[model samples]
Target: MDLAMLLAVAGLAQTPAPAKLPLPVELPAVANATADPTCGNRPALAERATCVVSTQAGVEGVLQAYEAVFTPQGWLVADASGNVVIYMKRKPEGGCDAFQVLAFADGEMAAPAAPAYLAFATIPRDICQAADPNAAAPAQ
Candidate 1:
């Protein structure tokens, strides 16, 4: 077998994996997502950011869409809190740190204005490990 084929067989291919989880589609007039807030603002150690998509989609619809997007990129669900599901994967950047994605849906929070909001968070690898109990091991 050729060198490329041999590497693939050995699971040693150097192909670059997706750096992060696939971002959910953002609907019109989307707003910036914020952190849990209770974690306090410690920007020096790790950074946190959120993305929101406004849509009329249902809970399952939103969750399924994210699963499809993240799965293809090698992201796996790590843990779920209430309605917010957390996914994690090993990231090559940031010194082989762990990356995390949090997907959630809320209709009431937006009130009679947005109708529904699909939100997700991009958390630093170190931050994810420290915060998630499911961080026992890297997601396959």
Candidate 2:
């Protein structure tokens, strides 16, 4: 290769890579909600991505809050039951990502006007499948 071409190649190799942005997993802000460390954190691929929040909205209200915020953002409701809901969305890089909410309100029974603890977790597609064999396979 020519001397100029070699120098250019070396410069390109030494150029610092662009800084990575924070993970796309974060809970939507809810009225009268605050972080609740009592639920602790769950580990993601790189770090703890689970967020436990305390709210007076109750379990049903928390579910509604998440549905309202995430549905418009392209998140699909994967599953919803009595006190738990899971939402899934296609990741920007590839595959699917899941956001799960588990509510523990007033010691198991969910009652309106009582304090509720909601655990929000972000799980990558690979981990999600490994954790549950029956889970739908991620899109290629």
Best by TM-score: 2
lDDT (Cα, tens digit) per residue for candidate 2, span 1-140: 11121111112223443332333555667765666654433222113334445444444455577678788888887876655567777666655777666555433333346555555655434434555667676799
User: Ten-residue segment with the worst summed lDDT in candidate 1?
Assistant: 1-10
TM-score of each: 0.41, 0.54
Q: Candidate 1: which stretches are off by over 4 Å?
A: 1-49, 54-57, 92-114, 127-140
TM-score of 2: 0.54
- Candidate 1 per-residue C-alpha lDDT over 1-140 given as tens digits, one digit per residue, 9 for 90 to 100: 11121111111123332333433323233133222322122221123333333333333454565567667776677765444456666656522233333332332232322323333445434554576566576679
CA lDDT scores, all candidates in order = 0.39, 0.51
- On a 0 to 100 scale, what is the lDDT of residue 1 in model 2? 13
After the best TM-score superposition of candidate 2, give how far the Cα of residue 14 lies from its true spot, in angstroms: 48
Model 1 scores a TM of: 0.41
